[model samples]
Target: MLPRVVRFDLLFVRTDYSDDDAWRDALAAATAVHPSNDFERCGAALQPVESPELSGLTSAQLVGLPRADYLAELAVADAQTMRDQTVLFVDLNELNKQVGRTFRAIPSQVEPIVANFSIANMDFHEFADNADPDGVFRGFTR
Candidate 1:
């Protein structure tokens, strides 16, 4: 049998928690099992933008903005910058182990956070080439 390639779609819900801090803490805990590179491969980032946009906007234009305004702008910009979906590829046998690892690595308090998120899986198989000319007709008749 061929090794199956499984794809897991991890969907994040922004409103799962009541507050930003709780959500951030939950996310941190959930992602603690994997490194930034892993998340990157899955088309996600653990952190927000590293630098704020400073080239176009003047200091004068940014100076008077409220803290909430800045945060909101950053959120919008970050959302626009990052990929909208995250997908992870794994071997079929490793899928269950990976889930177990993630669950075990996260703190008990944040276990519910991981539970709230959903993972959907898909399996892909590679096409095989037949060596014999009669292989295609093995199960067919004229």
Candidate 2:
């Protein structure tokens, strides 16, 4: 028998190497606007994450729980612990397919990290991508 595992796109950028406005850029990368062709006004709450927030959290913590609890957890996360990691969980299926999405949070010197984690099969694999000097992931894979 196979156990089920939910799959979502996990994107991350290290704050230490990115531009000073990394958080704002990260937020922009998370949004897509093409349903009515207007700016998206609402979506997930962006927050800092560490133990429990990232490790101990369950599927329900993201899709089922109230935003307040999650936000509260983020509020107390040790700023020191969150020093350089910036991560966002997204669903490519939920995004507007009509629009083109380019990954921009990673820097050129930083080789982009792309991977697949499978729970049903209990395995993980990493894929590769080529990056320009500016760090935007152009559609081709290396």
Candidate 3:
């Protein structure tokens, strides 16, 4: 039997753009060609990661977890290592804004990395069935 995987949308971006229409457009355009799933089926109800603080991680160690490409690679690798089917739903809108000018350039930088990984492509709804709807693996520092 396939492993019972947990899933949750990782809003790489903050909540500032949740109400921004232009941001949504850009996000849709970028995600459209992404080798993932149909963004249209991705629902808005998928719980947002509320805090920018990475869970399950201590602040001191987070600074050293990895940087840029390395950090992204770690996340993907960790997900794959799980014994269950796990999906990390990443939201690029807030992510783009966080890096300011670099935001728009992000999809290009991270997409290739994510594509090469064995991550699964799923919508918010599908992910919920796998992961805790209210509990995103925020990585604790402890």
Identify the candidate with maximal TM-score.
3
The backbone clash count of each candidate, in order, is 0, 0, 16
What TM-score goes with each of the models?
Answer: 0.21, 0.24, 0.26
Q: Write the per-residue lDDT of candidate 1 for residues 21-62, one digit (tens) a residue.
A: 554555554345443321222222223222233223322343
Candidate 3 per-residue lDDT, tens place, 2-117, comes to 11222422223322322345434434432344343422222221112223344343223333433333222122211121222122333222232321111112232233323333
Candidate 1 residue pairs in backbone clash: none
Q: Is candidate 1 or candidate 3 better by TM-score?
A: 3
Q: Give the least accurate 10-residue stretch of model 1, judged by summed lDDT.
A: 69-78
How many clashes in candidate 3?
16
Number of the candidate with higher TM-score, 1 or 2:
2
Query: Which stretches of model 3 miss by more than 4 angstroms?
Result: 1-11, 34-110, 117-142
Model 3 TM:
0.26
Model 2: runs farther than 4 Å from truth? 1-25, 34-128
Q: Give each model's whole-structure lDDT.
A: 0.24, 0.27, 0.28
**What does candidate 2's lDDT look like per residue over 86-111, in tens digits?**
23222222232311122232221112
Model 1, runs deviating above 4 Å: 1-8, 34-142
